[model samples]
Target: MTNPLPIPPVTLGAINMEAEDPQALAAFWAEVTGGTPAVSGDHVYMPAAHDGGFAMFFQPMTGPRPDRAASHLDLTVPWGSRVATVDRLLDRGATHLWDVLEEYEHVQWTTLADPEGNAFCVAEHPPVAGH
Candidate 1:
């Protein structure tokens, strides 16, 4: 029994974000990601909508929000529709930051900020072989 077995792969279960208004911010993210938000004590939790979807937890912060975030989220869309998604997000109260694109490249992405000024990216992915 000298050899040890490797640990199983772990899936990302949830991400914690700080907000001035936890419940409101959680609701906003839940709407954006189609998750379900529930209030629990001082934090708001958003359960995943699908098998691969990760939960989101919003916690209330005492002072003002940070000027910069340590990390941001990246959302993906079907290939050739990244711009459309950016447009749609813009119409949904997102602020367009910039576009990362180049000719002949199959994948492209755009950066945006949520209403609370949190940065996120929307990327386009190539279609699978069959569909």
Candidate 2:
């Protein structure tokens, strides 16, 4: 066999984000992307087609809600997918934040937040080529 590489052994195979309610978030994510949920004990485990995606353990938290200073994600709509995408997201319970207008006739973005208050923006206007 070829000599082993000098890199350290990979100790982790997946990542689990700790949400206030794992099952709720897990179901929401699954509904949005058609992902499957696997439960074991008190954790809601999910695996996606990508690597390092086989785990996301959700544990319970008590008292007032905790702070998530830097937990979020961004999704994009390349060009012709803006209208339908935004509408679909709205139907799924995402709340409107703001609509960034470039001009009366143009929009740069429309911001929205998920049910749990994670903010993300959808580009209402896509960049043109050769500009």
Candidate 3:
């Protein structure tokens, strides 16, 4: 086999989302993530909880939303909080798509779409090894 090239030293900075109204979308995410939103020109930004944490950026949308998003955010909540968390999100304008609980042993998740129809999931899982 050919020698593998050295891997680049890089880290994910932020996740950019497209929205019809950047400010409104940013507000929704801000509420969901408890992150403060800031507006800069036509774009809006929601800084991560702390440095090196995951951040989000909202930008003006130029095309229609896809029927199936190729990727989506998978948010994990404390154990035994998934139901309540899903309900809260629904109250905050999220649409419940479906749920998977019995499909896999010890695995459960609820799929939802934000106000802008961007899909995401809420689940009860262990925290990442590091913040």
Task: Pick the lDDT winner.
Answer: 3
C-alpha lDDT of residue 80 in model 1 = 72
In candidate 2, what residue range of length 10 has the lowest lDDT sum?
A: 49-58
lDDT of each: 0.82, 0.64, 0.86
Q: Which one wins by TM-score: 2 or 3?
A: 3
- lDDT per residue as tens, model 2, 28-108: 666544568787766777766354334444555545555553654544556667668778878987788877666544346
Q: Clashes in each model (backbone N, CA, C under 3 Å)?
A: 0, 1, 0
Task: Give all candidate RMSDs, comma-separated.
Answer: 2.9, 6.5, 3.6
- Per-residue lDDT for 1-131 in model 3, tens only? 77699878898788999999999988888867888988999999888976546789999988987788899998877878999989988998899999988876655899999998999998886355575
Q: Which of the numbered candidates is closest to the native, going by highest TM-score?
A: 3
Better of 1 and 3 by lDDT: 3
Off by over 4 Å in 2: 1-16, 49-57, 62-68, 101-108, 123-131
State the displacement of the C-alpha of residue 87, model 2, in Å, after optimal TM-score superposition. Answer: 1.5
Ranked by TM-score, the better of candidates 1 and 3 is: 3
Off by over 4 Å in 3: 1-10, 51-53, 126-131
- For residue 63, give model 1's deviation from the true position in Å: 4.8
